[model samples]
Target: MRIDARRRAGLRAGGVAAAAVLALTLAAPATAGDATDHGRGGQDRTYSFTVMGTSDLHGNALNWDYFKDAEYDDSAHNDVGLAKISTLVDQVRADRGARNTLLVDAGDTIQGTSLAYYYAKVAPITEGGEHPMAAAMNAIGYDAAALGNHEFNYGIPLLRTFEKQLDFPLLGANATSVRTGRPAFAPYVIETLHPRGGKPVRVGILGLTNPGVAIWDKANVEGQMQFGGLVETAKRYVPEMRRKGADVVIVSAHSGADTSSSYGDTLPFPENAATLVAEQVPGIDAILVGHAHQEIAERVVTNTATGRPVVLSEPLRWGMRLSVFDVDLSFHRGRWSVEGVDAQVLNANTVPEDPQIVELLADEQATVVDYVNSVIGTSTEAMSAATARYEDTAALDFINHVQAQAVQAELTGADAALPVLSIAAPFNREAAIPAGEVSVRDVAGLYIYDNTLLGIKLTGAQVKAYLEKSAEYFKPVTAAGTYPASALTNAPTATAPNGTPDYNYDVMRGLDAPLTYDVDLGQPVGSRITGLAYDGVPVGDAQEFVIAINNYRQSGGGNFPGVTTAPVLVNRQVEIRQLLIDWVTAQQVIDPATFTATNPDWRLTWMGEPLTVTP
Candidate 1:
């Protein structure tokens, strides 16, 4: 059989390749698992191989940015999409020898772009349609992949369907069924490599997803699946992989290599624990880190258990980079032993997108472009989110308006009589809707994330506290004066030492009435909120109100106050982007005069006086 056939057979059988087939392996010692001489085993031999990794592909199959409705580019001029990464991978394979290399991914593959959303919602792949991601990945010939938290965004049924369409195993050792407490997905996969004349080497790959999934996607995974700590899960599975005759072990962890949790003790496990797994788990050789969206060429951690070095690498998200891990092994005493491991990341912008990938998904790409450009409504006046972060803009108010209406309509029982408010953030600084014809992309650009809307109850005092916490986004000003927007926004706090992200700074607005407040930058971090009121009246501490929030914030993301424990009032599993689109389709017109607050809903203040802020 051919080498590709043998590899597929090994993957399908989930074990070592047949000995007879190993003898017939392609005649090349330069490649992985190929010995210098085709002699029978009995002497020491060495082999080298490469593992190419990617994470957070996020439904990018091409170099086009769906939100921009144009080819993707930025001030950095960095390229995105799997097509570019494929070109880089092909170069690595040619340089390292095809059989000597393997391809894998950390996670976040099935969601992010319009291409992914179309197949998932518009013309679901579950209805006998092939998903573009599965097609692109299969054509690239991936050996294995891990699960990302976003994989559950569309719920389990869609995720399962996407999983079934893949040719490779999707490993998730820590994701377990709630009922039986057993693994809900494949725990790990053992891949065997045959040297020309040496003993076969078995490589174990373990996958651990983010435990935050239980909180972020509670509406989808509340009673179906549960996630465990990465370190604990690695400890349990690494020893088992060794017992199963794994010569080397690699972990594809969908967690960051840091020591912090957005949920803050909501679960016993830390949200970003890849470094902990490397330090505490003895058998790990290398790890491909994901979920942080940061670029890390290589990070080495010494395992406390064995004092051995384990290498970790995280290629930045959205296919901007590809991580390459090089491994060297030696055969001795009738077994293979890992000698060394190192890793580095390759920039996808260094090469043009592979023509094969472009050709394969050409039709799918066109469909998404056409869908996003299709007219959904018309705008009476243009609205820009340029200054939404520091000022109240019509764009954000429109979002809150739609979200508040959705929650208010869904309320039942006593919650129905309570006034409703909604929270929104400046997700994109460049998002804007041009006057006249509006398209799907126009609305989607305003809301870049795939967040679902949810309604939770909070007291008047809790609302003020939440706003106070959000006020932490602004640096303390000594006096009222004109200041650069950048200087005042994204203030650093204990939870966000690097500075708070704009998405974490939420702005609250009422549905029928304005929930107004002033952010006193002159005040300290915890006491910046003042003039808190509902409908021009001071809010009482005991007054209760329902607030519309996104699934991420409501589920402890950003470590916002009182939201996680707040009583959930509505959860329809509706994507906020979809709701915006549906609302636009129904309204057929987006007029800022109708939604924009007559007076500013919020303002920057210093000692009860308003201040001017500039971008």
Candidate 2:
């Protein structure tokens, strides 16, 4: 999972060379246009075209059920559904005829919500079964789409069957067959569009999944295939596209752009790929990106050598926004060059829903509604799952306490009195068990990823290093501060206004033993951790203690140091969700007042003053 920085540097340097060649080949002075202008230059000789893209649909075919209501409400705020997208596509096509428009998706279309879960479990797309996503995409008419990492969640055989149901081609330049050495899926697609009274223009579309797919879903994809680098694959395919009579090349990249430097074993910056592809990929005019669930429009990436503009666009997730890129291509000197380019974000809420697509999703809608609405257990008092600032939640603390106790019992024959601690991530604080009937859906909020429990032995020094690594997620208040503003800020400053900290940038669970140290936000990897101790005692570097955490952390999910090398004490067959369920069942009655931060060793302060925590 380690990203070789040298490899990234080499790729960037290669991009410069490729950009130089592309500049010489496509050197032509051309006019520009705006939202009103249809072409680049004078008269009606110019060919105008539009590319529409969608990403991270996540199987939200219906509106979001925030209240777990049986009936869906289209009028709700940000209620993004595929039906709305269908309507918007129709309207756009009607406005700018089919000949001038191309529709594309950036993947992650088959997972996330209850609808997708039910679809995969109840009536999967097999030899004789029907896939609703295929039918929906066909109804709306997609030109091509890239394969997302999540597509491999069901394995290759089922994926091939799912692909068979779609009318449009699935593109993935880097994904190749293990046995044949050729592409397992279509690498790219060339489409010929003829504008009114104008010559036909060929558009080439290439697809790429995130390169990290190998690690994310290794069990499903590793044996059958290998995913090549996005930049390298695009460089290989773009020239071939042009040789095959394609006038313009566009990359439908499932990888997203990143501007942060928090690179580690798990989190990777796709900006490197984006920069390399834009500069190196010959004939590529624009890139439609996804997988980050971020909203980007009309980012002008300059080719390092050529200085030409490569436009990039990404409209948020779940059918919320449609990215529209207008490009004017003209044939001169027996070759087509991009004359003008502009992009915009089309709001899904502004358009009316299409009735036909709604009817198509009716049965699927009822199934999801019932699944989320079915009650499992009830709580006498509201058990708030919220993770307070510099503090843990009662729900998560209780869950971790159970896991820690379980680990201790398993390791020491149920009679040992070692100070056992369990680690739990705080990002799973979105669900609240209201003072009423709690369902299986409510349990999903406490433990989302279905991670398994893992017990390992770690010394106090290693535990402090792990905490320091976790603290790296936040920005320090000073040159030597432990807390991030998102974790400890009390009110609006010149910086953050909302006063509410980001939940993801909190202290690491466990490590309740106290210690004092200076934290450097900009410290180099492996050096950020120092002044390590546990329980007012300078812990011996060789001293080992049993630590409890989920299987993800055990397998290096969050990039915690020394975790992968730790000795395994117990591999609990039960999932984290099952553990939470069992614990809740054992407790029966829930109370929010009992919820308190168990780990007192973790603390955050701003400018040497301790920040207040609000429940």
Candidate 3:
């Protein structure tokens, strides 16, 4: 994150030259309907090209849902996996002419689905096996890809293996080494396009990653790789790219276009700052955004520096959509000038799965399917996370129970005597474990994130503050009444103006006894927690306890209070999802009675009165 003084001086000097370059590269008026416009006369100086982009692939190789052990489909009829995306890509290539098109990704490539887990932990690609993502993307012929925060999930060695398997470069302009403060990956790549009768067009692709990687992946990147702000980083790199003779600059940003931060001021830079980069940085024509998992066809931001329009687009996650950016350039006096930029998203469900990607990943897909389907244990009763967010559920309690037990078993000295508590979130509402049998996928679905376990010490007062912070997930109610789950959940706040995600609403539970509290929706966010107690007694401010938490939360994720500076009681570096799987495999039976509290663990209230909720 340290800025080099010499580099700043060079960037300032380059900015003067970059302004001259922009003056020569004039923007010609063109409509979105126009694919290409030959010169004013018979000259072929006008060029039209396409950039196809995908983000947050997360190791979905085919249109198969390993959790359900069936083809992936939803009520929206959306299709997932790279196989479907490949078909869409081929269609775009055919229509736009393959030579005039380029394909790239916005990262989060290595960890999401059960297939990704199988490769990272079950059958690691580091041991000479080809990663399915690498094989699929290589075959698809990608030009370049940006580094995502999730790329550091399994650690650096595994990421390096996946990077080497790729046919193209993996770029990260702001990802620098802590020891050297130099770029760890290629900042950008220049691709030359040859027209029929005009000079070749040099297109610069700059990749910028999210700054939250410094907090979310602190375990993997701490003291090794540091991420810098996108706006500042782009200011330094764009001029250099222009100096390299790049006529048009396209940014593949692995950050959301919104100017928001989920981490709540934990870092100096915002988590989602793609729009900031486009507005503040000059010489950027367009940006391909990622990480928000939303579909944005086209958004134009006028640059503050040059008053020029910068287009941006984002595809839906898990290969459900593909973003296609159409760029038109005009050649004048032997120089290529940007004419216009347009973008749109294509639904992956509209096309059939690409047979090549499906066949290439057949072996790996089969291996993961078999592994996830293998029965690990039997559940005495059905459990679902459908209502875990608005009401207490046994499904989320199961995660906390397993997490707490693991930490308690490993505690030593003074930590062993301290009472143990566990925190969990309803990551997936559809996650369910049916009665009679449970498999690895059943447990995996409960904890969708790839977070490791950590035991951090906190006082009773700190625990209450933590619960109060989580209470922000619920909207305030003026009076007690029956409310719909959707109406009360995901309350909007300054930090989470779009509403808080389920993964950030943590529910804490005691290991030996229920950690009970009331979420008084009638009160404001910070004062919503009430009747806090542990072991059937009121919790005292001085009372200390060891709480089992995910590395994401303990490492400053969600911007929770006191946890970042809390003393570490234990650090097993074990994935919580794997711990759930191993616990099921060893116990051979998942009984809710063993973990579920006899009384209601927590309840929703409005002005000291219990409130009713409906699904």
Worst 10 residues of 3 by lDDT: 17-26
The candidate, 2 or 3, that scores higher on TM-score is 3
For model 1, how does the per-residue alpha-carbon lDDT over 327-375 read when each residue is reduced to its tens digit?
9987776778788998999998899998988998989998989998899
TM-score of predicted model 2? 0.68
Error of 3 at 72 (Å): 1.7
Per-residue alpha-carbon lDDT of candidate 3 for residues 560-593, written as tens digits (9 for 90 to 100): 9999888876664567988899799889999999
Candidate with the greatest lDDT versus the true structure = 1
TM-score of every model versus the real structure: 0.80, 0.68, 0.75
Model 1 stretches with alpha carbons more than 4 Å out? 1-42, 179-181, 378-382, 386-391, 403-431, 434-436, 448-507, 518-530, 540-579, 582-597, 603-615
Instruction: Please report how far candidate 2 places residue 190 from its true position, in Å.
Output: 0.7
Q: Model 2, poorest ten-residue lDDT window?
A: 20-29
What TM-score does candidate 3 get on C-alpha atoms?
0.75
Model 3 residue 590 lDDT score? 94
| Best candidate (score: TM-score) | 1
- Model 1 is weakest, by summed lDDT over 10 consecutive residues, at 15-24
Report lDDT per candidate: 0.85, 0.64, 0.85
